[model samples]
Target: MRKAWALLALLGWLCGLAPAIAQVSLPADLTQRELVIGTRVAPPFSMKNAEGAWEGISIDLWRHLAERLGVRYRFEERDTVQALLDAVTTGQVDAAAAALTVTAARRQVMDFTQPFFATGLGVAVGRGGATAWLPVLRTFLSFGFLQGVLTLLGIALLVGTLIWLFERKHHEAYGGPPLRGFIAGAWWSAVAMTQAGAAQDGPRTLPGRILAVIWMVASVVTIAVFIAGITSALTTQRLQGVVRNVGDLRSIRVGAVSGSSTVDFLNAQTVGFESYGLPAQGLRALKAGRIDAFVYDRPLLAWTIQQDFPELEVLPITLDSQNYAIALPQDHPMRVALDVTLLDTLRSEWWTRTRLRYLGNDAAN
Candidate 1:
């Protein structure tokens, strides 16, 4: 009985030790050789300060991981995200430490650490003006406007037919050939809808006078309603601008970052978009009215807008959900170690402060 109890205790101890052992099993060379980490200038993820020192969310996270793992590493900056990712895939760099998004195509070529941040594609548009007239034009051409016109014409026809039946024989204004009488009555009704003095030329028959009085009062209400609808439409159009959601992007001049996940999404949806080299360039185009909308990563857009492009606003729209993770060479020996430290660092209080420092209240919890 004593031997069996000791054996059971030993089994439990070994089970507990397995995870710790696996976590520290980083290859011997990973610690000895200075690891090459690739990065690109993607604001809040990777960027150089005025002093020329590199710093950002991904950079901080990597530094934390390196400190914990006791590994020496050096950063190799690349001009574009694709170049950074390519460096990782080719083992030109041991890992990519930028805002690398994990996709199936990338995964097929290089491994990725568990995602550190979650975000989606967003649209950035100029705050106001430039496209203001577009909304007004759309309002006038809208189905509601056409429907209102049709309903008004129908009412005029009905009222004119009634007035002609009562007054065609008694009043010269309405007395004529059948078609002429109808036209005269219809013109009177339309005029009365806009002017109260039009009632003076109303039909002479008692029944005709009664119908005229009722229509005059009703016309007041109709005119009020019509003016209110037009006013409301113009106000709404001016306030909401031209684009309200993703569906509105189809007809507008759209811009996107070249070689980004946003471009992939726009292509998949069959949306024609002009590609810009960077988010700042795309935003500048939008501000200058060259592009109606600029689409890119939500967090990155928020960061850029807050930092350099205050004249712009990011629409409260999200598309193409994505996860940002560290890119690494295929089956990298340090991947497991990196993931362990990454998850721990992400779950710590320091990570919260780091994110808040860069993203303000926009930081994802």
Candidate 2:
């Protein structure tokens, strides 16, 4: 009886071991399972082509990941990045891929795979309205320029008065009545200062001629200084309108992609901006003068501007540098798998080739 009891106990132990071994050896069937992927129109990352077919760097990466995992996926277009995040959080989609920047706030709600790309925010402005003359005109109206002009006028009046005093007694040009002589001296001084010849004979006395010579030299120097000031003012004015850094964005009409981190940054800085569903839309608004500047991902915006909006320019300044990653639901079962694949892909030559293909040769590092 003891032997039979031992045999039954051993069988039960083996039975328990069998299921555990099976669980360890046979993985879940991820193959052929339909995975819904959420995405939005973010160029060089994810976008719909001319034929309404999904194609981009992120789309291709997702396809490659699915192929490697022996899974099938269908992309579902979302209007905004926030919508995509919501879809993943609500289990509406298995994953989302775009030029999605990974942030601490986003990490709290959704899991992001290892970073595949790195970029920053860039500013874009239209080329048509950025004329050099506009800045020059603006400079002429500035307080500094006005002050310089006023000071120059005061010096000119002083020289005119002195010339009237010196030439009034001797030279015919200033021999008339006091008021008339002074008026003629003022006219002659104005003409001499402009490098234009005087309409009448200059002062005749030694003191008067010496004064005239000094005034002529002073006028030459003053004119040169004034020209230099105008040039400097023009340059300053041109740069003033340019959105070089985030702080400069406040006074301009800025546009950002709706539900994007760029919009969050702009809002945090209290900069007034218009939001668009896509980068292309924001570019359109910039070109149409609806917005003075457009802010978005550096690489994606650079690529789009280079390809479609040749008239626009990306600013040299980059803001809020961040890493781009594929977003998954929090504590997702596939998180580890996707992360492994992403890390491998980013380290491989495939990443460089893919990036160059989509972003072109001038892609931001």
Q: Give the number of the best model, judged by lDDT.
A: 1
Which regions in candidate 2 have their CA more than 4 angstroms from the true location? 1-34, 49-53, 64-72, 129-137, 154-188, 199-201, 205-208, 232-248, 302-322, 333-344
* Residue pairs that clash (backbone atoms under 3 angstroms), model 2: none
Tens-digit per-residue lDDT, 1-365, candidate 1:
99999999999999999878646657888889998889989988999999988899999989988988999999999987677777887899988888888888889999999999999988888887767577788889989999998998898788888999999889898877999999988988888877845354578899988988888889889878998999998997777667666677898999998877788788888889999888889999998889998999988898899889888888776877899999999988898888877887788999999999988887873
Candidate 1: list runs displaced more than 4 Å: 1-24, 195-198, 204-206, 222-234
TM-score of each: 0.85, 0.72
- Candidate 2 lDDT for residue 211: 88
Cα lDDT of model 2 overall?
0.81
Model 2 over residues 1-365: C-alpha lDDT tens digits? Answer: 99999999999999999755433211365454777889988787888888999998899999888776667778999987888889988989889998889987888889999988887888887774753244456567768889999998888888888888988888877877888888888888888899876446787889878988998998999999899878776776666546656766776678998878887788888889988988899999888888888999888888899889998888677888879999988887787777766666777787788888877775446
Candidate 1 clashing pairs, residues 3+ apart or interchain: none
Candidate 2, position 133, lDDT: 42
